[model samples]
Target chain A: MLLILPIIVPMLTAALLLLVRHRGVQRWMAFLGSMTHLGCGIALFRLVQSEGIQVLQSGSWKAPFGIVLVADTLTTLLVIAVGVVGAATTAFGFAGVDPRRESGGYHSLFMVLLMGVSGAFLTGDLFNLYVWFEVMLVASFVLMALHRTKEQVRAAFTYVTLNLLASAILLTALGLLYGQSGTLNMADLSRQWSTAGPPPLHLPLALLFLTAFGIKAALFPWFFWLPASYHTPPAAISAIFAGLLTKVGVYSMIRVFTLLFQRVSPGIYTLILVLSAVTMVVGVTCALTQRDFRRVLSFNLVGHIGYTTLGLGLLSPVALAGSLLYVLHHIVAITNLYLVGGIFLRVRRTTDFASLGSLYRTHPYVALLSLVPIFALAGVPPLSGFIAKIVLVQASFAQGVYWAGGIALFVGLLSVLSMARLWDESFWKDAPDGVDKASPTWKQLLPIGALTLLSLGISVGAEPLLDMTSRVAGDLLEPSAYVRAVLDGDG
Target chain B: MELLFALTAGVLYASGLYLMLRRRLAQLIIGLGLLTNGTNILIFTSGGLTRTNAPVLAADALETTEPFADPVPQALILTAIVIGFGVLAFSLVLAHQVHRSSGTDDVGDRQ
Candidate 1:
């Protein structure tokens, strides 16, 4: 029951929210549901730590036959991060979203989206993963188009088309893999390939999965859909997408590359590293030219995905740990940044940075709250991003991959420059002529304050989190424990 | 017999991609539908064709024996087809909305 609660809680919440008629009651119920999800996630985190990796085979059909839900350290940590983002974004949406859009089933779709995220993280079956991806895609499609603006309709075309293509590719990969291995269970496939050597179609299958996930993760040359569509939605919706959606793709990539491929291909690693370097360069450079507030963050989100992928490419324990930590830090900081953008949109009625300014002088508290995510995202010292970058660089240098390490450091500098530019234009510059400015209500500031405190908490608790991620990296490197736990427990 | 299925899938995929590459919204939806159907056929062929055996167990038997058709791919295809149908329906509605809103079906013209 505990194993399924993460997905079930949101499912039930969305259903109940849909049934409720009163707007005020619906808002409270959504908040209650998300908080319950957070509680379940924390409980699961505690359970995983005490019990090691937890696997639940649905319907008692055994591991290779039935679907399973596995919550290893990596999955649990991501679940917790999703929980934090979900709760914060839910509150932000309540305050920031227009009443008409909010009434158009926003709360329910948001819960369904969280349910999909949890399902994607926990499922140990490849086909089930595809199903969950569809769930997320459907919910997000409606959420993006809820406002029904001309720009949104245009962006939704690209978003829906490209995402559907990716899903189709993912389905093809699953079908082919099942044909090759005769099983869709991830652990079973990993065990078969690890013990029996690479299957005949292994390379093609791996590349297929890469292509599918690459589009989802917004990797270089495949990321055009993200920046085009991400800025079309409300800030609350964009905040959640910026926080968790692409990370799901990264999570799957890390899971597949580590478990199925076993990190044995030096050529593949080099390819990923080079691709990641190029992605970082391209994303940050594009971000530099963006004038819209959320567009800049959207492009920067793409660049940061490159950093996490770089960690995956390095494949060392330290590097993978860094990758996981980088994902966690990005989730918190980026979501907070978007919430701050939401406040700007709420008060000033626009997210175009050129027409926006003087928040540092006008609302010192908002500026102060904004600085935490800005500096954290910029990899300033003692923050979570800094520690994660240091670990990745240290791992790359230790492995004698100096060029990738150099690019990582160089990209960090570029990210800082882009973020500084954002700061100067949005907060530090003088207010534009004849723009109405209204102070944000307390409800709007509350979630931002909570998320800022959460980011600070991650910084302060970095030591234990790093230690936990290091253990996760160790398990991912030698996945025998994961396989044994899933396969053997069935008997 | 297997070769026929393979050829049909290939044609579906080819035509689907060709149509999808066009700028019109209606063609895009049609292409997506064909593409998913092609994938379904691909899975069915790749799972191996056994015309005489259907993998159904006898009343007294606990499990079916060899030479029986594989049921897993059929199950997978069923799920995929359902999901594909729903998604295609959603896309159709969205494309109609786009056409009505923008007064054009050419996706390229929107930008």
Candidate 2:
């Protein structure tokens, strides 16, 4: 029952929120619901850790035929991250989201979004995954266009159109896949694929998966919609989008590549590696060119996805663990940065660096809060981001993937430059006269404080996190158990 | 039969892409609809079409007998169509809003 709770709690909350008329009730309910969802996620993680992967086949239908949910360690970890980020964003909405947006079913759409994300993480069937993607896309597109500002509607349009194209490709790929193999279950696909040798149109199918998920993840060339659109939303939406949304794409790639299509082609990995390096370089460099603080952070988010996919591209245990670590580090650091961006907006009354200044002069505490995640993100030591980068670099070097290692190091440097530009322009310069002087409310700070503490906690307790990732990486590298868990070796 | 379906899907896809690249919102929406239907037919054909049977087992028949069309692809396509319809409806509404607010549906005219 608890296995199903993560999806259920949010859906139920969202539905209930729709009926309630009072704003305060809706707000507290959304916050309480998010915390409950987090509790379920942490418990689910513990259950998976103690017992191994958990599977639920809806309506007693067996795998390869029924709708199935499997919570392996990787999925479990991502679920926990989702819960943490979801809760923080919901809390942040208290201070940041306009009441009009809330009245427009913002909380409901948000829960549906989480439900989709969780379903994607948990589902065993490929078609089920597609359905979940649609769920998430509709929710996110609506959220992007919630304000119906011209810029936001434009952003939503681009985001929706590209994503729908990606969806068509994925469906077509599934058709091709089912034409060849009779099953859609991930575990079943893995077993049949290995037993039958490589099927026809394998590379094309893999490329289809890559194209679909790539747009979602904002990998390299397909990443334009991301930076173009992500900043259009206000901070709450941007924070969650920056954290959970693209990571699902990365997760799907990691899951599918490892479970069903391991070594589908060495050519694919080479393409991935090349694309990832380019993604990293382009993402950070573009961040340097942006003067708007949120836009700079959004660009940074695009670039950092390269590192997680880099782990998948390398396809080694230590490297995968490092990539896994990088993702965890990123979810906290990036989301928190956006939340802090809201604080900056509140204090300075603007997001543009040219007009924004002197946060350090008056609100040193907010500046200090912003600094923690910024440094962590730039791969500064003692932070989880530094540890994640070091591990990835070490793994690349150990595998003698010199190009990957070099680029990881290079991106770390450029990251510092982008972050420092924001700090110097926004915090170091003197506050311009007659700007709005209201400090951040506790409602806003509460979420920032929670996420700031989360980043610190992940760093301080980095060992357990690394251990869990390495353990999960082992399973991902050798997925026999995962296949068995899903398929049950049914004839 | 398979070849005809394949050709139709291809032509629809090509046209869809072409129309989608156009600036007009109505054209793009039509393109999206065509693409959706094309993919639906593609899945149906790829799953191997059948003329005479639903995927039901006869009463007292424990198993699906004598080459009923595979139901899964139909199920998948139906899901896609429903989802596509909802999305198309939303896209149309959004387009109307875009046009009303911005006074043009040209992609270039969007903010």
Candidate 3:
């Protein structure tokens, strides 16, 4: 029951919010719902830590036959992270979302999106993962279209079409997997993978799954849809998308790469390593070229996915820990940066940096707030991103992949340059002519304040997060406990 | 029978891929539908041809004997079809909204 509550709480919240028409009541309800979700997340995390892995089978059906919800250390940690982002974004959405959009199921859809994200993180069946992806995409499409502007609609076309293709590809791959393996449960497949070597069509199936997840995670050559669409939505939605949606893809990739494709092929790892380097260079360079604040963040989001994949590609326990840590830091920093863009939009009345300036003069507090996440994102000293980068670089060096380590450091440098460009344009320069000079209200500052505190907290308290993520990484490299806890749930 | 299903699925996939490459969003929707159906058929065919009893056990027996159908693939296909339908419906509506707002179905910065 505890294992399933994280998915259920947000769903019930969405259902309840859908029925309530009053915005005040709705906002209060959303707050209640998200806070309740965070409670569940923390409780579930501690429960998993104390009791070890937990598996909840649907309707008392036996494992390998039932739709099971598995909560391992990695999964429960992801749920906690999702809950953190969900709560932060919902609170921020209160002020960041447009008034008109808010009245029309904004909170409801946000709750549903969180449910989709958490579901994707928690599901134990491949087909169920596909369903959660669909659920997420449908809500994301509607959210992307909520603006209903001409440009937004155009962006939605690319977003919807590409994600639909990715989903179809994943579904087809899953079908093939089921046909070949005669089981959909991940634990069952892991068992088969161990007892028998790579099953029939294993390489092709792995490649297909890689392609599908790559698109979702915004890996190189398949990430165009993200930059094209992620910026058009309101900042609150963009923040959540930054925080969870792509991370879902990373989570699944990690899960599948570790469990289903356990050989850790040097060929695939090299492929992924090269792609990570390319993605970093391309993503940061593109970010440098973009003038719009959200667009730059979106492109950067794509590039950061490389670090996580590189961690997985390294296929070492230490590297996996680095990747997991990088994912957590990147999610918080990226989400907070987008929210800061919202505060900027509220002040400047435009997304273009050419027309927006002097935010430091207008609101020094907000400017300082933005710096925390922006510098954090660039991997500055004493911050979460910096620690994560050091871990990855050390792991690469330990593995004698000096070029990968060098590339990680180089990417960090480029990331700093791009971040500096934004700082100079948006904060250091004089105000452009005729820009709006509105200040953010307390309502708007509330969520930003919370997130800023989180950013600082992550940097200050990196030790616990590091220890926990590294432990989860250890679990990821070993699968018997995962398989037994899940399949043996009949006990 | 397997060859026929495989061939038809191939044709559908070819046409779907073709339509997806076109510039128009409506055609893209059709392509998406075709792709989903093609994949569904592929899954069904890949499950292998079975003309045996269902996996359900007899009233007096604990489990079915050998030579039963692979029920998992059938169940998976059913779920896929349902999910594919939902995605199709949503994408169709989204494409319509794109046309309504952007005034052209060509998916680019043409708006």
Candidate 4:
């Protein structure tokens, strides 16, 4: 029952909001629904930590026959992250978006987007996962184009086109897997795949899955559409994308690679390691040169995803735990920065760093708030980001992959330099003559302040979070518990 | 029969790729449609052919039966078909919107 509410509450709220006529009522509905989701997510996390694994077989059907929803430790953590970020982004959306410009459709779309993301995190059936991906994609398309500017339209086109193609690839892979295995339930598929197939088919299926996930996660060569589109959307929508959308792809990649396809070809890991290196270098290099604040942040966003994938490719328990911790850290840190960037844009009325400066003079609290996460993102000591990177680097060293660790450390330095540049250029420099004056209201500070406080709390409470990540990583590596629960559930 | 279906699927995929490489919007839509159909055929062929056998569970059917058409792939293909249709409709509308906003049907012409 706990496993189902995170998805159900938002979906029902979205439907209800659609029927209502007033915009204010819809906003309240969205806020209430998102808060309930967060509460449910925390409750589910506690339940899963106490129990082993929570499974909800939909439509009263059995595991191999009906769709199943599994909430294990890993899934629980992801759900909590999704719920936290979802609530924060929703609050940001309410505070940041202009109701006159959005009117009735914004609240409903926000609810649906939350539903799609939560559904993706929770569903256990392969085909059902695809359905949720489309649900998420459709909502994202509508949200990305919400403002309806020329650039928004063009960027939306690119985003929708690339994602639809990726979805097509996912469908093709699903078709092949179902035809080959005769089961779409993940547990049954894992069991049958180990003993039933010839060696030749595994490589193709693995590649197909990798390609689909690679595109979605914004890996090196497959990540062009991300930077092209992510910067043009509203900052609130971008915050959600940064926080949840790409992480869903990472979650799928981790889930499939670790759970289903265990005997992945040896060379593929090497390829992934190299790609991670290139992604980190390229993303930060691009960030170093960008003039727009959001674009620079967008590049850094892609760079951090590479760090997580690097940990996954290393395939050590330590590395995997680090990856999980990094996922948690990056989700919080990036969303906070984007929210701060939103505040900056709201005040400055432009996204370019060159045209704006000296925000410290006008909004010293926002400036100080922004620095905390920026320093954390730079992997400063005694912060969550530093702890995540230390674990990741140590894990790579344990596996004797010194080059991968070295590159990660070097990239960490570059991330700091790029962030420092952003701080200096956007907040510290003196405002030029004839620049537009800022008029910031207190409501705008509420969401930014909330995110800032949350990051500080995570940084201070890093030990418990690290322990939680280790436990989750252990569960992910040995998914026998997940498989057993799915197979043994009531039909 | 299997050979014929495989050849047709291959032909559709090839033609779809060719059209997708073109610059025009209408051609891209056509390409996507053809590609989806080709994928459907590919999935159908991967399951192997069974003549005069169905997956329907009759009242007295045994658990183990010879030459039964695999129902799982067909179920997967059904879901894929609906999803493909949704994607197609959404993309078509998006293309229309793009055309209206940009006043061009050629993807290459946009800056």
For model 1, residues A63-144, the per-residue Cα lDDT tens digits are 9999999998899889888889999988876675667777899899999999999999999999999999999999999898
Clashing pairs in 3: none
Cα lDDT tens digits, model 3, A468-490, are: 88888888888888889888753
- Candidate 1 Cα misplacement greater than 4 A, ranges: A263-265
Model 1 whole-model lDDT (C-alpha atoms): 0.88
lDDT of 2 by residue, A1-491 (tens): 67788899999999999999888788788889888988999999889878878988888898878988999888888998989999999898888577678889998999989889998998989999999999998999888887777777777888888888888888888988888787788888898888887688889989999998998899999999898888778888989989999999999989888886785677888788888999999999999999888999989998999999998899989989989999999999999998888876777666888777877877777777778898889988898899999999999999999989999999999998888887888888875562756888988888888888888998998888898899889999899898887777321
> Compared with the true structure, what per-residue lDDT tens digits does model 2 show for residues B3-84?
9999999999999999999999899989999998889988989889887767898899888776788988989999999999
Question: What does the TM-score come to for chain B in model 1?
Answer: 0.95
Instruction: Indicate the TM-score of model 2.
Output: 0.98
Which regions in candidate 4 have their CA more than 4 angstroms from the true location? A96-101, A196-199, A433-437, A489-491, B57-66
Window of ten residues with lowest summed lDDT in model 4 chain B: B57-66
Pairs in steric clash, model 1: none
Task: TM-score each candidate.
Answer: 0.98, 0.98, 0.97, 0.95
Clashing pairs in 4: none
Better of 3 and 4 by TM-score: 3
